[model samples]
Target chain A: MKLSELGEFGLIEIIQSIAEKSQNPRYDSWRRLLVGIGDDTAAWQAGDYIELATTDTLVQGVHFNLNVISWKELGWKALAVNLSDIAAMGGIPVYALLSLALPQDLEVENVTDFCHGLAELANQFEVAIIGGNLASSPDVVITITIIGFSKSNRILKRSTAVPGEQIAVTGFLGLSSAGLKMLQKKTTLDNETTNILRQAHLRPTPRIKEGQLLLQRGVNTAIDISDGLIADLDHICQASKVNAQIKIDRVPVHPLVKVYSLNQGVCRGQLNIIAGLPGSGVIANAD
Target chain B: MKLSELGEFGLIEIIQSIAEKSQNPRYDSWRRLLVGIGDDTAAWQAGDYIELATTDTLVQGVHFNLNVISWKELGWKALAVNLSDIAAMGGIPVYALLSLALPQDLEVENVTDFCHGLAELANQFEVAIIGGNLASSPDVVITITIIGFSKSNRILKRSTAVPGEQIAVTGFLGLSSAGLKMLQKKTTLDNETTNILRQAHLRPTPRIKEGQLLLQRGVNTAIDISDGLIADLDHICQASKVNAQIKIDRVPVHPLVKVYSLNQGVCRGQLNIIAGLPGSGVIANAD
Candidate 1:
């Protein structure tokens, strides 16, 4: 029967029944490791460490519009988003598992290309592709979960922020938002600026190396820029029991961004232009 | 401007501009780490251990059709599918951050309900709701990335399977496939079977505990069942440089599955049904 007729749950049931054979491989042995599949969370004791985990799912037409990105570009951007999280916690990345749900009619060639794109980036970062789930779905949905290690002493957390810490960012801003405008208006961008903004949208380079460096150097209280700068910083402020002072003018807009803002018809400084509402919407009070 | 107008880069540019502060207590030391926002992946070290990370996307119409699911159930399943990947690696679950894209017309109530459903499952699993992203789009899509940890010595990898190790699974089989049949046919399940299959579909219990147990017991090769059994097991076999001798008769079937197969007009034997391949979907030679 068609997927619609089966309904989502019904389809999941079909999938689950087939998977029943895979349970309890190491069951019944005491000290057989402490976690199993039946609880709210899985735990393990490896010498001095116990770690936590989960994954990322960015859906098509939802997280991003196809008309907004190239397949290669999308592949890179999707993975980068999660890497950013690990960076937030002062964790270095070690492993990753990716799950893809694509419509049947999607081009097979594109699938291969997509994997190649993701793999190329993963390889550069030394992130191992540990294998993942591939399924036929109605849309292009790629979900990934990464596992990393911390020395137990250094896993940074949101709750640990202090009230007096300074607020700072690494690179220029407003490029990606500008890229979105270009896509929507179907305007042409020069090679340099196009490359700049494209990198922002298609390939968000999470500050992995820097994050690790910070953690190693004893930096704590951090978050990556998945949400807008002000919003994410607000997270630090709130979690740390402090209110942040934002020098909006201090925001580091890339040269391309500054140019795009001035040359393009789109208003660059407009607060509403930011996706996470850096100074508006839900996070308005944040900055 | 709408997201599409932002193109890929433009959106990111604006995001960078607005996100400015971080709570990193170590910020003074790693003035360099001031930006864990790398070009793609973040490289941070937790204590002495390093982590690797990334995320992917899923969408409706583009990913799954919602008419086939209750909104609340969709919320549960969306996260479940991603967590399944973490399980595949025998990793621990810890925190999650979300980036959701929804059409403006969708009600705040629907959004809240969806979040409640997702959060309930997350909290139940001990996976923290650390942070999230919200945006406007043509479809309703939620993207989440969960962070987890593992020690180098204890991690179980798909590529690490040995040829002679016994391969096994955790739970029953074929019920999900059967449940889909029931839903498509609009067939009602009695209260008992209904409970079984409905849970299978709407809220799949991730095998986190089992994976940790496997890892603790030092079992090296494993994967979660997101794809069909034959398909998923084949991945292990191929990666491990071995062919499996799966006893079609050894796989378990839930009691509800047996009842449904008998009365639901499908060809089946108790053992074969238990092993999945209800209607000759499993080939004798392939076995």
Candidate 2:
């Protein structure tokens, strides 16, 4: 069977199962692994604080087209994806290790520009780009591993929410997808609107501060919306062993998203949000 | 300037300079980063023990060819390189995060085979295969990030050696390089010799136990020989602000390496040793 038939999520599930069934007893005993494959980050105890780690990869053709996005934005998005995983765990990101596979003919200036973008985001989050590896390849590949720490014993997880809770979101949804649609179509719009959409697609922000805030406010279950709102929400439901009833009208969609949908001759309901949860907040049931 | 002109090491130097100059002040104040770049691993303080991290990437054409090496061997080599970094730091490797970029047409069986190889090595070292990311790409790319811990306050650093101290290595050198040559040439040799050379290339062991023993013995400075013996020794010498006088005869080489070199009509001296140091034993100079 080809991996394409199984898709990315299916492949991950198989890998997870293999890892779980074949775990080394000595490793399990020695390393106090608090979390492993299924969570947003793999966590372990390191003294007073719990250490969190997560890794992500971006392929040139699969993840982005250099013709459409600037190298700086590509760099920012690379780190942002890993940071989002750490944010989902409600941890403070401390260090990052980058591994790059670049084409032999890549320009040095483009490489520097990518670093500048990465640096900009790292500066914003106060994450130190500690170390990384570089190699030559047929295409460009970027992998980032982020290490973080959480003082609170209570870590927000995808599997802690109840079925009776009312689902809510932190911010607007579908803007990034709309932005992607605009870019794909090469739709010409007013400068302000185009800038808004382009930035949304090219440089989506990780909700680090918001995640920390949610944890502080006693929200026990959360996840970052990277793989569409519905898909990510489904992950939370599956992990928590509960079903969700999402009111379509209650879903937050940016006004510009509707415009993009209308222009593209598609329904707004079909468009997926790249960030901001389908329903980020939860209201407790009265029982 | 093209990145090819700068090469891997030069590019790393440039990246390191940029990262050092663009460091976040808050990160510096809050997180105590002990070692950042230009070392085998980046290190930080984590309560009683020091935490260590390092990452390495293997591209299909640049690092290995599937025609010459098995998927399982490729998987083993991927983790082995990272383990070598941890060993160089005198740390116990605890967790690993893998990020893979594979072509869309890759077979599911191949991925499973690769996982089996990775799991085998992870089991051997008792390092947990915690989490990873996978994406579709034009070629295969494997990136492994290892996290480790050091109990001792003393860490073996390249810059810590004194001018008078004699350099040393742990095992035989040039075997991996010789193995590569044999594979590249598709040379047919005796079964025993072929197995030895092939194993050396495919599943080179990381000297984790040796590193810990050295640290216990108060050996202050050491490094792994990944980029040839002379090149790596040069790093130690340059970092320590000293000069080295290596006796070529003192270098350890497998008997088959000599045989392979003779068969290829190349001088043994010209064939670089991939592992083992020039002079592993520390001999104090009587000044």
Candidate 3:
């Protein structure tokens, strides 16, 4: 029978039936588990430190368009995005778990390729894919949650940002946004620009190490640039209850973007469109 | 302006605008921030222990059909599924970030309800809605990444089950799947059963406390039951390099599920269809 026929509860029972079979598995130090999978809560001996856990998700049409993005890119981005989160906290990324909702008819090759892309990034990031959950859904949805570790003293939080610290960013901005535009416009470009922008869009390079460096220096408050700088910074500000002023000039934009904007006769405001966060107000300094 | 006009980078810039006007910002004490953003490799701090992270996504057509699920339920589930990941590991959930993609023309109230749902869950779980990205797309997508902390040595991995360990589960299973079936079949149900099944689907509880209990009690290796029992258990077996035997008769199935299945004329595998984890091979006795 179709999944719909089995209904939600039926499907869950099927899932629980199988899930119940997982049993207690893993390392000797953390090995002997009293609670396996049959309870409302679970417990492990954390010892003296706080538990570091992180989760991320990728939607089919939103995060990726199968037609434009390669499985490898999709896989890598999926992992990279999450890794970036751990990095923001001044912590080390250890294990990863993926929850995937895929179209029933997805090809094995597609999945394998996606895995390869995922592995490539995972390996490079030096993190391992411990396990994950897979299910059939109307669309492809990939969600990954990771467990990381850090001392309660060391874990950086947005609430820790103080008033006087200097604001620093690792890489240039606007390239990924530009590349996205290039893709949508289907605009042809010089090999140089095309390669650069496409790479940015398909495989976003998350700032992982920089986060660690900041944390080691004891910069306890941190955040990743998943949302644009303004919005992400807004989070830090809101959490810390502080105010900040950033020069429009200090913010970086790609060279080609300016040229493209000029060529397209787009206003400075339009150029600034790549600067806001979700649910954020209008972009200031459009010029 | 339409999102596309902002170009991907341009849109990000727009979002960044939200973060720009913060009250205070600082970048110091970070000794090893390798690649923060706009770079090839991201390097950050790795203290004495490792870090954990994960991601999950819910889509309009895939995870829920607005016609059946209330906006509140949709929002609740969006965060609930991610929290379930943290509970699966027996970890204490701390912070969460979101990435939502919505089609143009959605009503403001709908968006507010969604946010309300997310905030309520986060508050209830004590998980902070730290930061996330957003975009516009044809389909509505909600992606969330949760960050939590656990002791390094005590962390559980899926590959740790011992040969003789017991397999267990928390709360009832198969209820959501059963609910989905009824919805799809368009079958009528008593208000009581409908409420139970719908609640099962809408606000299925996360096993946070149970997982924590198990973790504290030394349950090291585990994974959540997002997929059916058969599939998730297979992961444990594969990871642990061992086989498990669980009694089908010993398995737990909700009473309401039994009633629904019987009322629906289920037999054999269908007995627990309403809230059953079916097609999962059951071992005679897991002892």
Candidate 4:
């Protein structure tokens, strides 16, 4: 069967089955593991804290077009996505290992610029770039593995959203999708709105503080919206075994997205779900 | 200006410089970090034990050829290479995260076969497949990030080899290279010899127990021979600021390699350095 028929989640299930089969009770590492295979990050008990690990990969032409996004922004987005996963788990990122597969003829300056972007974000979060691997490939592929820490009791998860709990989203959504649309169509808009939308798609802010705040306030369920509202919500629903109802009017859309949507024949108060782009979408559940 | 011109080590230097610049004395993680970039793994203090993390990527057509290797072997090799890095650090691998970029049209059985290989190796080490990312790409790219643990005092390093210490190899060298050559050339040999050589190249074992034993024996410097004898020894020499001299006659070559080498018009006492192949070449230094 083709991978397209099996789908991503189906593929994940296959891997998870193999992973689960290997969990021997004899291994002490299995005893310390709190979460594995299916969460934003795999978490394990480490002394007084829970260690969180997550990996993300970006392949050229599939995830980003070099002509559309700068190498620095690509670097920023790559790490940012992993940061968002940690944030979703209510953890503080500490270290990262980057593995890069680059074309042999790619410019050295591009790589340095990529590192600069990664360092700039890493420095902000106090994350150390520890170690990684470099390989030669036909196209650029960047895979980042990030490790983080969180309080054992305060860890947020996608599988614990209680039924009838109210969901609250941090920051505006759909702006990134709109920004991508504008870039694809070369839409002419006001400079401020254009910058806002473009930056929203190109560079996203991970809700690290907001995630911690949510965890502190006794919110236990959270997921980063990398795959838009519907898909991400489906992940929570599937993991938590609960149905969700999102009021289209209640979903927050960025004003810039609204402006862009208006120019593109979309109605106000419509739920604009940016299906496949990493956008400023952080959602949490509060009882 | 190109990546080829800068070379892998030069690019790594640029990354390490950026990483070092971002290291703030104020961050507590830095205080706990014992080793960062330029080593087999990055290590940091995690309570009483030191945590070691390493990442490796295998790109299709560059690091592997589908025509030459099965998907299951590819999976085993991907994890095996990372395991070797952890082994070189004298650490016990505990957890792993896999990031895979696969072609959309790839067969589902191929992925399952790959995972079967990974799970088989992972179970042997008692390592948990904690978390990872998957994306669609034009070709298969597998990057694995493995985390291991070692006692703080027992951690081995490549940079600590002394001036006059004798290097002891844990296993035979040049077998994997010979295996690869045999496969590439489609050389017909005795079935037993061919199987031995092919297995060495396809399923090179990571010397986890050997590494631990070396550490227990107070051997503080070690390296795995992934890039053959000359290149790996060069790494130790560069890192330790010492030159090395290997007696060609003293370097151990497998009987199979010797047979193959003899057929290829090489002397019995000649040093067969199989560069750029993951092989059973674990070398350690004891005072």
Candidate 5:
């Protein structure tokens, strides 16, 4: 009965069931809903455009450590993760709501630095931080809800992938997980490699443009590789009702992750394919 | 420099400044944005409709005690608070994203109960729980983002109040705070009063229909009295650049709260006029 037994996905299933059953069939908004609950984003029709909504939360000790990640990096990653969800749907993020629970003793600079980092990224994509809530808590918590929109014809969904399509990724994989390992273990690497991996983990660039490009080229299925490569691939497989045959040797592995794996005596593939390890790579399904 | 030293409002000022400074004027969404931070909800033009988005966070211990509040009540309250924000905007809530950080040792029933409570309230308003994120944390953290919309002409904003408008609330005040005190202090009251006060705190109804009616009646300025009467009135005053003179004798107080206050030897007005106590009453500015 413990949450540890049910796990995150299990808990989501329970909540989703309640959500599905709780909806009033007579409600007018149901007419506008395109997708709900089980996807990178919930999407609905908004006149000529399709609106997208997704939310993500980061806990102080569970998601990040203050020692390993800078306050600014924390801010950047929080927004980046939500942006990735929109990117996966081939949507342009338009606005965000940031809710924070901070310890009372924390310094103001930490919050301001976080805002600066978040705003810096928001400015890049032209996304606005519109509204939010702040509360006191024992640990630092940040939850961001991102609202995005796409041209109705161009929006992508994992359920649209055909059986014979090809699966490809936008960027190198495993560097984030490798960087996380290095940071957690304090494994020393060359300055360039450390910066590459750490930045990959801490300051990922959401593939907003790449996703749009994919959709323009008629790719209709895609997801962000935040929950590792295989897990995300499985999401597409389940949603699209298809099977995937992976050529393990062909999987793109970052050279930095390879070096770290070798230095730490861990298999590069473990870093590359395992579940739970996170990355910013975009997995796209194309004809 | 500490968060306590700056307080919530001071920190909000710093964040609002950063958000204002960071927005790119050239972005396309900016042209559609009608309101951003420093409001009850962030709103923008979405085709013929004006879209509204608001987020609220509830932290255990800070917002509620599990010993005093049931998990179902927690769920209802979490969604109700966000719905209150949408109501304050005179918008109909359509969707929500729930982000929860819960202890791993917690029971599955607890989560399901929370979802049931949330879904029950959401069902009443025909709002869908579209998407969300879940994470493990030491404390229970619930953050909900509600998305709503209104006819462009029907939307309300706190800053729209005019100097000659009269300010009045939709319902009695201080019941929630009084109920909270009764529960927290274990005050022994008659069964009827106890039930009334406790329910007021635990299952306070959101004034969604009342808000829509206000908007229908051309009331363009309103806010939920979740931050007590004076503080919320101060928000209206500050945003609209007007002042209010409330007649203390005319402020509506629940008879149950009065009874509880009298029993506890506390002044009823203190409970009614304070800044931090929360209620579900909608304060309206009408001509």
Candidate 6:
């Protein structure tokens, strides 16, 4: 069967099953692997602390077209997505190992620019890009593996949400999706609106501090919205074995996205703005 | 300038320099980063123990051709290369994060076989395949990031060798190189010789146990021969600020490689069989 039929998530599920089934019984005694796959970050007990790890890959013509996004933005977004995974688990990202497969004809300046953009974000998060591998390829591929440490013993998990909790998000969503739409249309948009949408797509800020604060304040259930808000919420619901009733009117939508949707003759309600979590809140339902 | 001019090593040096210069001083106080970049693996203090991390990428057409290698061998070799880095640092590999960028047309059975091969190796080493990201691409790219724990405080380093030390390698090399040549030439050879050479190329055994033994035996200088022996030895010499005079006659050439070289009208003396190091001995010069 074609992978497209299975989709990315399905492929991951199959791989995860294989990994779990093939796990050595001897490893069970290690007492280090606190959590493995099927989570935002793989958590393990390392000495006095727990270490968190996550990996993400961006491919040319698949994740982004270079014609639309510059090398700098590509580099920034590649690391950003991985950092978001760590943030979802309330961990402070520490070290990153980057692997790049570039075409032979790729310009050195472009490669340097990509590194500079990655370094810029790494500096912001205090993550050290310690080591990586480079190889020649037919297309550009960037893979980043981030290692992080949790601040507290309690890590926020999607599976821990209670049924009666009132779900709230920290930032407006659907901006990136709208931004991607705008880029695809290539229509003439106001300078401010274009910048707002492009920046939303190109420079996503992982909710590291917000996630840490949420955990500190006793919030035990949270997940970053990389997928659409409803889809990610479904993850929490499925894992927690509960159903959610999200108030559609309460979803925060970016002003630019609203305008962009209206200009494109689409209803504002149809815009999926609940993606990219800056912070999320859960209140206990007193039934 | 194009990246081809800089080559892989030069590109790495440039990136390493950028990473060092851009390090945030806030992370300097973490006291966990024991070692970073320009080494076999990046070592950091994780709670009470030092942890090691390294990543390697294998790209289609660059690292291997599908016509020459099966998916199983590709998966095995992909993880093996990363484990070699951890082994080089005298560490025990614990976890692996794989990122694969595959063409959309790739068959499901091919992917399943690849995962099985990877899982088989992971089971052998007791290393858990925790999590990974997969994306569609124009070509296949496999990146493996390995996390390991050091056996001792004194991890082997390339920069610690002394002048006049007798350098000895644990395993004979040139087999993989010879195997690649045979594969490329499509030449028929004896079954035993073919199996020996092909196995060397397909399934390289990382010297993890030997590395731990070396550290226990007070050997402090070593490096894996991924590059040619002379090239890798040059890294040790340059890092140690000394020159090495390898006795070519003392090098152990594999019998199959010798026969292959002879058949190809090449001199056996030209073979640098000290490439892959399960354990390399470097004693203090008594001069």
* Candidate number of the best TM-score: 5
Highest DockQ scorer: 4
- The TM-score of the first chain in every model comes to 0.75, 0.92, 0.75, 0.93, 0.94, 0.91
Clashes of each: 106, 9, 151, 0, 0, 3
lDDT string, candidate 5, B60-111, tens digits: 9999999999999999989888888888888899999999999999999999
Ordering by DockQ: 4, 5, 2, 6, 1, 3
Report the C-alpha lDDT of model 2 over A1-287, residue by residue, as the tens digit: 88888798888887777666657555642358878887788888776778899999999888899889999998898988888888887888889888888988999989988988998888888888899998888888999999988868667777788856767665778777777778877989889889888888888788777777778988888777677677778788778887777767766778888777777786665566433333333421100
Report the C-alpha lDDT of model 3 over A1-287, residue by residue, as the tens digit. 43324443343334233323322234222242222211111212354544455555677776778888888788888877777776676556655655566665566556656777776776565555544444445667777665555533355566656666766666666666677777877888889988888887778765666766766776666666555667567766765777776666766677777776776566545433343322221111111
By lDDT, the better pick of 1 and 2 is: 2
Calculate each model's fnat, 2 decimals. Answer: 0.02, 0.72, 0.05, 0.90, 0.90, 0.75
CAPRI-style docking class of model 1 based on DockQ: incorrect
Return the clash pairs for model 6, or none.
Answer: A173-A273, A174-A273, B32-B45
**TM-scores, in order shown?**
0.60, 0.94, 0.59, 0.94, 0.95, 0.93
State the weakest 10-residue window (summed lDDT) of model 6 chain A: A278-287
lDDT per residue for candidate 4 within B197-257, as digits (tens), equals 8888888788888889988888888887677677777787788877766666677667778
Ranking by TM-score: 5, 4, 2, 6, 1, 3
TM-score of candidate 1 relative to the true fold: 0.60
Against the native complex, each candidate's DockQ, computed on alpha carbons, is 0.06, 0.65, 0.06, 0.86, 0.84, 0.64
CAPRI-wise, candidate 4 is: high
Q: Give residue B282's lDDT in candidate 1 (0 to 100).
A: 15
RMSD of 6: 4.4
Off by over 4 Å in 5: A274-287, B274-287
Q: Ten-residue segment with the worst summed lDDT in candidate 2 chain B?
A: B278-287
Which structure is stronger by DockQ: 2 or 5? 5
What is the fnat score of candidate 3?
Answer: 0.05
Q: Model 3: runs farther than 4 Å from truth?
A: A1-69, A73-106, A114-122, A125-190, A193-287, B1-55, B78-91, B111-128, B144-194, B208-256, B271-287
